[model samples]
Target: MLDKVKELNEKFKTASPQEVLEYFLKTYKGKIALSSSFGAEDQVLTDMILKQDKSAKIFTLDTGRLPYETYSVMDNTNLKYNIKVDVYFPDAKEVETLYKEQGINGFYESIENRKRCCFVRKIAPLQRALQGLNIWITGLRASQSITREAMHLVEYDENNKVIKLNPLLLWSEEDVWDYIKTHKVPYNKLHDHGYPSIGCAPCTRAIKEGKDIRSGRWWWENPEHKECGLHKK
Candidate 1:
């Protein structure tokens, strides 16, 4: 797996995202799946996956705190693709306990509190959704963050014990939008409000121009440490 990752990276160093996706589809077959948050980049990738293989499984973490538009897209995607998007929800007991003790806004107090919220709402559900999958697809790009800057089109995810293929690793924000427009893909309407990255509703908002892609996400924290821990190694 490591040798194949190294081989594909050097071979597709200059290849477009479409090329990388083609390679992934050819390689993994049904053992692979795409995890999306239904943002523009995600919708772009989803369109590509459907074009390549309509049987490609797509899933998302609900987080139980998403915007109404995200929920609408989930339903819209089902009707558009004529396929079911498996929704992963948090552990019921954990969520119940968290809400009972700390209330909903506890995440604003500290990083620990935030991680706990993420664990229940996103991470735990993500882990459940990944079980039995040999490959995991995502829409992450290098330009999104310094952490993702060193990423490749294909890499092994030791955490999930699977091959993590980021087919759009090298795409820019403009590239994603262009693809979406060209394909007429369905997307959330919040992008026009300076929200380059979208997530659960309460914890996300838009940022000013010239800011980073993830600056609006978990913005109250030190910039270097604002990740939701889902994509963290």
Candidate 2:
């Protein structure tokens, strides 16, 4: 399976982003869905999917901590695309348990607490998002983080039991912006202020001029503790 995954990745690495999306749309028999955080890359994908198939399932995780601008972008995307974005929330029980145990400020204490918060807020909902899906699309690129540097354009996600397709993995940041500009894709207003990757407001910040892409995320933590662990697949 590993060898097959490598072979598929090699093929996908050279495929055009359009071709990849088209292939997945048919390969998954239109059962495929995309998760968008409304970042630049995500907006670009939303545009592409809307253009290709208006009925495509586009969804977001309402982690309850996103910026106001993020929600604004989400609203604009829906208005522009004339499509409904299904939203998923963390389980009620898990959220209640965590809030009771650590309070709302749990993540600020330690890496373990942060992971626990992310698990309840992200990983669990993400699993629910992929249920009964054959292909899951993302806005991830290789340059985003060290852990993601090892990622391929197409890989099997054992964690979610689905085929993971990162259509933009080979595309550069300039490439994403170019498409967005040419297509007039709706994007987060905060991007103009230096936010390349936008997640929850509290967990993300603007990057310095020379900081690594992952540096802006969880900036207070050591290099080895960067990932939120929800992307482990």
Instruction: Estimate every model's Cα lDDT from 0 to 1.
Output: 0.86, 0.84
Show model 2 residue runs off by greater than 4 Å. Answer: 1-4
C-alpha-based local distance difference test score of model 1: 0.86
- Residue 189, candidate 2: how far off, in angstroms? 1.0
Tens-place lDDT per residue, model 2, 11-75, is: 77678878788877866766799899899988888887777777888889999888999999999
Please give, for residues 93-198, the per-residue lDDT of candidate 1 as tens digits. 9999998867889999889989889989998999989888888999988899877888878788877788888888877888888888887888887887888889
What's the lDDT of the predicted structure labeled candidate 2? Answer: 0.84
Worst 10 residues of 2 by lDDT: 22-31
Candidate 1, position 179, lDDT = 85
| Strongest candidate by lDDT | 1
What is the TM-score of each predicted model, taking all chains together?
0.94, 0.94
RMSD of each: 1.4, 1.5
